[model samples]
Target chain A: MSLTKEQCFDQLLRSHDVKPEGKSAGWLEQIRVEALASAGALNFPSAKQDDWRFTDLSSLFQHAFYPVDSIASVKLADIEKFLIPDAIRLVFIDGCYAAGLSDLKRAGSGVTVTSLAERLGDLRVEENFGRHAPYKQDAFVALNTNFFEDGAWVHVSGEIAAPIHILHVATCRDAPSAIYPRCLVVIEPFSRATVVEDYAGLNDGIYFSNAVTEVVMKDHAQLQHVRVQREEKNAFHVGHGSVKLGTGSVYAATSLAFGARVSRHTLHVIQNGEGAEMHLDGLALIAGRQIADTHTLIDHAAPRGRSVQLHKCIADGAAHAIFSGKIIVHVGAVGTDSVQSSRNLLLSDKAHIDTQPQLEIFNDDVSCKHGAAIGQIDLDALFFLKSRGLTEERARNLLTHAFAAEIIAKIPVLSLVESLGRTILDRISGVRT
Target chain B: MINKESRILLEVKNLKAEVAGVEILKGVDLTIRAGEVHAIMGINGSGKSTFSKVLAGHPDYTVTGGSATFEGRDLFALAAEERARAGLFLAFQYPVEIPGVSNSALLRLAYNTLQLDRGLEELDPLEFDDLVQEKIKVVEMNPSFLGRSVNEGFSGGEKKRNEILQMAVLEPKLAILDETDSGLDIDALRIVAKGVNSLLSSDNAVVMVTHYQRLLNYIVPDYVHVMDGGRIVRTGGKELALELEARGYDWLRAAA
Candidate 1:
């Protein structure tokens, strides 16, 4: 029998086997139950909604998704190509922690990195878990909050030299299923670290991955975060990331979306104390029948807050890319300075992009500016390269790569930057003339 | 410097072209030979730049009539890159800025492409770096300029120097400098002229399209042609440039 939307959601909710085991597990269990109740009350965002106006979720609801029942056996060699050198690796297979493939030996001093399942009862995990991401109205976040089996929990109390890499590998083999992967990163006062959250698919399978990540930065803490989503070509991914900054803290984030048939990511960052700085950079390079949507909101609630954002999208074939950025300087946010820019490149006649940058300032002593530009390959630049003995195709690809390098160069990780550059070059090499 | 036995590098015959359906080059004819440097000087509205662009096969200009041949081969039969591979180059007055593409990368690619055309092995990055380091000395450029984006945020003189740098690497047989000396100061102009003069040999030729004779003062031309109303009204020895510089282009326009 064909299932309805509510029936599918109910089955997904019932598939999770929640069992409170140890000290403070009851508190965690209570939070999960309340999230479950919220998930039951909320509905999936549809095309008629304001926030989801450009992204259509009707196709995501067509497939009946159940929770992963067993952990697929993944070998280290199977994931060897995805490993980053000199990084503390945490591997998860189908939303379940895979200890055999992870490297936790190099996690330097004053840092705690483990599976969320292991630290559920700890005071540090309990204090920030389910605290930052708003799940009351968002169905995806609520679903993740209620059903996530395990996740990566990183706590930094002092400086960490080695970067933390959370690798989430999806292998949906048995049936059409859903995986909820969550992460909570807490950087204590006066500490600094770098984190890389990466998601990849093992095969071309139809599945769903709903992810939620919450980051908390105390006073004077600095962090560099990079999120890369490279799912299979026939998968669906919805991710929500929330960040809260304290006084004198600095946060820089670069999000790269390159895969999946349909994907959307929402990032919300708020400066809750004075003199906090934030830099957000995003790039979506997709071709074929892909849709990548990004929505961001930066809220400056305190005085002397500063933020800068640059989002770029390069679409080829029949792909569609959407970017919506909103910056708000609340009342009494004096000396707030913000800049936002959106640049899009359409490589084919059928490719399309929609970019909207909005700013709301409530104070007189603030400087805010935003601009968006959508264009094709610069003909003059192409001619310049061609006049130097490069073929038209090579010139076009070179110009396209140059367009994307502006954002990829901002990534703090050298290895990631090199790999992303190679990927973009390879992707654009096959661009249809 | 003319040699009677010199092979013809480029020959133009009453070439006519237009942009946006407006005629810019009306019955323009010029001939360049190996071991020679020719300069075409004219007033602001004369078709000096248009004639050079038309010869380089710019897409915006339509070749309505006449013909151009390079080394006895039809120049119009090849694409822009093909013409470049055939040892033809144009030094743009305003070089376009290409952000995110490193200067070394573009130069190396252009160099390797020519190497392959000549049936030679391509150089690796290390080897290419060594070669480019040697070539940058021709333009007196800093080594750091090779690592920056192509022409992005470069000073006007620096952009011109970069053009000469490319010319040095490619070693084209026929190079048409279209107002390359317009934005250059005296010092930069001397440096650029020195680079071009060093590259000239008995086997290749140069065509300089300019409005002033200041550049010719350094890279002394073998012949100077006065263009007026989209045509070369007068051709003379190098002394013609001196006469036009002393007496403005009005006398040439009136004579035409």
Candidate 2:
């Protein structure tokens, strides 16, 4: 009672000299520390946290020091090596501005791409800064929105054509452990752009990537956001990306994750305005003891909006895959059309997939459907393919790769798609060609 | 190549099979030698398809009793794929559509499996493409067929030809064409029949099962067996097929 409202944050970090600054980010960061510290026993997975029961995350917190260091030592040429040839590359290291390596064009008088430090005072940033994130509810999200060191904000001015590809690479090669690369993309009215963001690894050292991407689609602006996360199997990754759709605007997001030891992505897309649309599709190829989780939410706040969520999982060896998707068609969201599908194919008898596809609709004049299926390779199809003279193992690999290829090809980035397709084919089929 | 002393390449002895607890192929016996095309003609529900499925090792049916020997090896000891690699191919009456598996890829896998069994070096994609392009002409299939998924959304005539394309790829010692001409128009049937006829060799054999005799006009058979009540009721030369078409299956069923 003797201190200001930021008093809670001061106590948690009292042991260190990293005091809060006066910038907009510093203010938000302080709020996150306070909120997380005061989340008030809301919930913690049991030592066997039912949902987190399978994942024992005690090792993630065991590492104490994490410093931001993907600086000048991490050269632009080095980042170029991972550009996935032919892809529109945009690179970010250690969440800061590396201007020599970014290719971004200003849009229609209203759009701009600038460092978060420069846009700290921009009016739009002030308005949409942390709008969708529930700082007081979720602990980790509040923490991310609080301590994000440096990121970019992309703003589209008007009716534009062409896609935007943003590549985020965490290149911290020493000094400490973690790197958080964040981005914010804002589309103005009637503009359209496609952005493919890549998350890659350059070192064999263990690290953590806690990224947050916020996308705002204004009236009539169409945006396609494609993200690929290919971090190391030794890394720990947690990312939250949220989008708010305006009236008549369209948003499509496709994400592919080749499993890390623990990679979890929590995504939400809200159709806040009428006549808006959103599509979310993700595919994960998991092997060894790696774990991948995709949790998504589609909120139809206005009437007559459209939404779709499709997630596919292929688990080999002793890997695990999880998908939890929820769709909410509010009472005011009449005439909404939504669909959710989760399809999983397990290669080993010990491989596991936990999927729950659910829907909560309050509007009567709406169409909502959900489906989920987890099964082994169809023995009949396998036998049929094998009876043509292919070995049993070869037939199984071919059918599995075919199933995953259906979704990966839709990514549309070309080289990366094929490279990842080949990797997945080799891992699943255990064949070189 | 199959190392069997017997002149008959395929010999069935009192083959007993069942589906869902009901017996379909009951105590049936037959034999076919190399360089012979034998046809099994039967009415609906007379168990003509069951014999081919039992030979193909379709898991749905249980072979309760009896045995089938193909190329001197016990066909019952092998699963469906092993039997195919050992040179036994069954041209499905209705080939299944694999939504995302390309026809070219499937053919390459099939062809390599056979080559491996014969102790020949396997062909990769590029080499397999050169080999497959030639085989496609046998079925008169379009070059574009190599790019599309196997049997997915294909028309009736196209599916039957695709089955023959698989037979061409595997080059089985004993080719069992089960109702291979059922859904084809007259023109498609002739093309498929031509493809099947070209594959006939002195060291290999073909077994054609069909209800209609129109297909015989394109590729003549060496022998024809009229089946009724789960057994061969009549056996004769190629003339029997023409005689059955002239007289109809009712006469053969009554003769049983």
Candidate 3:
């Protein structure tokens, strides 16, 4: 028999994952072992737990547990069905990066896109791998570290103009599959690149894609990271996209969610250095009983950093949307300018959206503001448009499109935005018609 | 005075109206002959606006009793949009705004709705644009206005002028201006009043609803009716408006 639950728990005690930080390299095994123990604790969130209030967590306990495995059968042609060319594409199978199929040469010498296993084989890790993002007491980040054996290792040199795209294809056929797809991207001083975390599922079976993307950009480096989730509705997805920006570094991220029955995408960004800028734009079009939660945190550790966040949600049927964004400014982080807004549109009366935008500023000389609005379509706008020669159904479709366009127009890719726009129009056409 | 051979444009008998379960117009009566310009001046909350809304069949104002005859048809029986298509129009005091609905699209709808109502061929976009240019010029409105969303960001003056433009396009037999002069400046008032005058014909009638005596000087109603406490208390010509202006609505109410 493989390792039992108690043995796994005992092994976690011996691992470095359980040990606290700065305790030396001997703590690595302890931290990893403690991560396994934390998973077993299964901390049940109650009314006191504010994050999972809208999402049902009781059902998670009933699911049959299985170890995270890696399968090799999934082909490239099957993955190619979801690929959008011109989008810097990096394909990974199971937990390992497939260099034979991936196109990373145009990325140039200024960029380093390699597999985590290869980097480990070559002993190329100069600094700590999972040091900045510790996984001690936190169960989820710990889980990420426990399964970090086969992740994508990436680096963008300073002053580089090109962007990088990383695609994570989570597949489960016959056996219960689970993989922790981690992204470790380091941007040197004054470098610029766009990193994408595109997650797509292959089959109709129940799978789990628990991912973590950790980024650290040096001074004057700019990075744009997009996390797109298009898994099956039966899939379970819980992810974290974390970042630490140095002085004069610009960071922008977008989380597009249209899959998974229960999916939560977490973002934690820190303005560690001054003169930095950050923007987080998220969009989710949820249907059926799908649940999508996007929780973001922006910490202004230094002074003179600017940030703007705008997230829009369109929920239909009984689908639920949850958005909680927090911006925290440290006491010395003076001249910190930040603004965040969340707007949600519920198409059906049964559909629900819980949006929260909070700002906690300790700096005296800083500008910080946040707002959230949850409302249905204006009925008057519908009748007015219908009276103008358009049919009643067509009129409502136009108004809903206009409401969503306020954010979709901000996307740099026109064709993708347009196709997404049309898809949204078609989805709501039933209500108007 | 109205022309005898032209048709009885509007006939209402015992028109009752209530708002939010509170009866406003107990039982009102009014009639407008073809080509006649009728003025309705009232004290605050005398149910003047309610009367116009009742005639337009606004869903909020329930018609508890009585009937309105328009061109020999039962006007109280139709829906709001149908009433508008059946040659009936109410220029609201506070016109509602639609952010993304274009003004040109709204005008086309009104034009086509009336065409369907009158059993005429519908005008296509090309033909409609051609027809609207003449009406736009007649109202002295800028061509750029057509590109804007319907009343989305219109100024006070532009909204009233837009109301008259709708009236000009619909060409209703009996047009009710529900306190349209409340927000307009002198220039906007003159332009709107001129547009109304141009639309006036032997086949159409105009009912000017106002609280001030100033608008009467420009519109020049042939007859003026004083309304107080939910009823018309006094009836006279242009002198009544001038007299009310000089001595307030109390003097007319006390005299009648």
Candidate 4:
């Protein structure tokens, strides 16, 4: 019989020889051991589970992928194209920090940006790392905690003049490998920052990129986080992110997923203090036989907290997209206002979309609303555009681009918005009619 | 007026069409010539709207047995966009609303496309803005409407007026106004009728489909056809519209 996922993971972990050392090694070792034990006890969710009903991860475990212990040889020049100009950049390749490609000098006094592996001795790292995103129940998160070699750690004390860009490039050589990328961002009280987590792959190979990000926002802190995933079509990507908001803190996040054969993103947010606000926006575009799934949860634990979310998916060819968003308002979270909307556009008869937007409120004074819709292109609108002398192809492309622009426009970075807009347009135009 | 010497802009012979396998237009035959305004007056379900839709190559309607030629070219052989590029414009009865696309963009695109089709110079956005400003006066439209989305949240009068503005911009060889007067107030009707009058020329033709003779009051028709039971039973001069209005379509149906 084939080995279970836990057995495979245990075997893979035993084969790696690197061990934590130095002054901060004790806590790191404890975290690693606890994560491994939790991962070993929990089973991988199958298709029979309600949350995994629409997604099948059987094919993902079929291949034997070991931890990438050392940095793979990747040229900085090759990854220069993925860098955002005029921004503080942290570049990581194969789950290891690439100092030659990063702009470490640009990080001034108000901002602190470094690899988490290098800052293991920092007291703040011990306080915030793995605190927001618990991995006891999630196999993917637990695996990332046990195997993450290096990732970006950003701490903002005051205000960051420019956005910080973290670029994760995956390059596989010789064997099908797996890399765990971790990110921890902490915004101190009365501070503000914008962070972009961008993932891109170089070559076409079988690789697994399991990533986790934890964000902690103090009182009155403002943070805008954007995650962009554009991996190779042959890669597998599973990412988890968690955010905790303090009193009067504001957190806004936008996630865009465009590539990978099978990808999933799970995001969780909690308003821990009164009057904290959260805004979440996401978009996924997939074609061919690709599958893209997104699951999000927002919990309002304090009074007068507000949250708004909008998620959209565009599926063409035989691709499938799944979205599940839930908002929970606890009994004491009075006057909480939460809204969630999910929209999907199917471009072909074979394309499929499953969306569920749910709201669970235990407070009588809370206002919560949720909406979900799945539809094809509007025929009336199509005919209207065609009758205006545009070719049917151009008309369809224009409408499809407009549908995606609703989310792309919400991004604060102008250059990133323009680049993502062009990418989405090109993909929509390339979809076969 | 229309005469035997005038150039024939559109010729329809035994045109039979249906929508969703239900026959709507049964053997409709009408000929329109240049420098003339023809009005097809009929009650509801008299196949007047179907004839216009079929002529414009709407995909929902299938031409089972018919022949429609526009300036010696087979109209049924082209797609909806091709028919539009060929200078056949249809002012829909109920104009569709596209939420995100701006009105100015749609207008300029249609204008530039027709210009390219006719080997004319295309205007840039600034130049097109000036031209659109000049044409909007025909319907007394506010310049702000051009900046908004195409017909999105527009009132009935505004949508009809927008349709006429499009016709003015495209400058088609043959324009079909399908029930363009149905949902308009008296003021909007007069404005729309006057816009159609100003755009008329000896090189092009207009076919106005209506159920009332009020629209023909401001823009008189050269030829009027009374339709009933999916066929035109009577054809006469502009006076036929007045007679149908005064004595209703039942008289014509009984006579046929």
TM-score per model over all chains: 0.96, 0.84, 0.75, 0.92
Superposition error at A297 for model 1 (Å):
0.6
| Candidate that would win on DockQ | 1
Task: Put down candidate 3 lDDT per residue, A1-433, tens digits, no spaces.
Answer: 2444344334433433433232123344565566666655643334356776776643333343344343466666877655555655578865557666687766676677877655653333435466666465445677767655466677878544444667787666565455568788888898878776778777767666778777888899888776778777678787877799999999988778878877888889999999899988988778788889888889999999999999989898899899988899998999999989998889888888988888898869998888998878776555443333345556666676666665665555555566656655665674210
The second chain of candidate 2 has a TM-score of 0.95
lDDT of each residue in A184-292, candidate 1, tens digit only: 9999999999999998888888789999999999999999999998888878899999999999999999999988889999999999989999999999999998999
What local distance difference test score does each model get?
Answer: 0.90, 0.77, 0.75, 0.87
Candidate 1 off by > 4 Å: A1-24, A431-433
Per-residue alpha-carbon lDDT of candidate 2 for residues B93-114, written as tens digits (9 for 90 to 100): 8888887889998888778777
Best by lDDT: 1
Q: Report the C-alpha lDDT of model 4 over A1-433, residue by residue, as the tens digit.
A: 3556666566556634553332336788798888888877765666777777888676577667766766677776898667777788999998888888888676779799998988988899999988778788887788888778888999999998688999999997677778888899999999999999998889888788999999999999999999999888888899999999999999999999998889999999999999999999999999998899999999999999999999999999999999989889998999998888999999999999999888888979988888999988888778767676778887887788778888888887888998888888788888321
Q: Fraction of true contacts kept, per model?
A: 0.80, 0.67, 0.12, 0.53
lDDT of 3 by residue, B1-256 (tens): 5666767878888777799999888777787898889999998798888888788766578888887898888987765666666677888787767654578877886688679768999899889999888888667899788878777788988988888888887788789999999988998888888889888888889999899988888888888988776667777889989988988887766776
**Chain A TM-scores, one per candidate?**
0.96, 0.86, 0.86, 0.95
Query: Of 2 and 4, which scores higher on DockQ?
Result: 2
Backbone Cα, N, C clashes tallied per candidate: 0, 9, 15, 0
Considering the two chains of model 1, state its CAPRI-style docking category. Answer: high
Which residue runs of candidate 4 sit more than 4 Å off their true CA positions? A1-15, A18-24, A69-77, A104-109, A431-433, B1-4, B108-144
Model 3 residue A139 CA deviation (Å) reads 3.5
DockQ value of candidate 3? 0.16
> lDDT tens digits, residues B1-256, model 1?
6886999999999988899999988898888999899999999878999888787778889999999999999999888898899999999988999999999999999999989988999999999998889889999999999999999999999999999999999999999999999999999999999999999999999999999999999999999998888899999988999999999988877776
lDDT of 2: 0.77
Model 2 Cα lDDT, one tens digit per residue, A1-433: 2333233223322312462242565555555566456443332223354445445454455443355533645676777645655333456765666677776553335557666666877788767766766555654455556566667777777644444556666654553356657778888888877777667666655667777788889888898788888776677777788899999999988888884577888788889889999888899888888888888888999999998878999898888888888898898999999988999999898889989887998869999989999988887787687678667787888888888887787775677677777877777866422
DockQ of predictions, in order shown: 0.81, 0.60, 0.16, 0.58
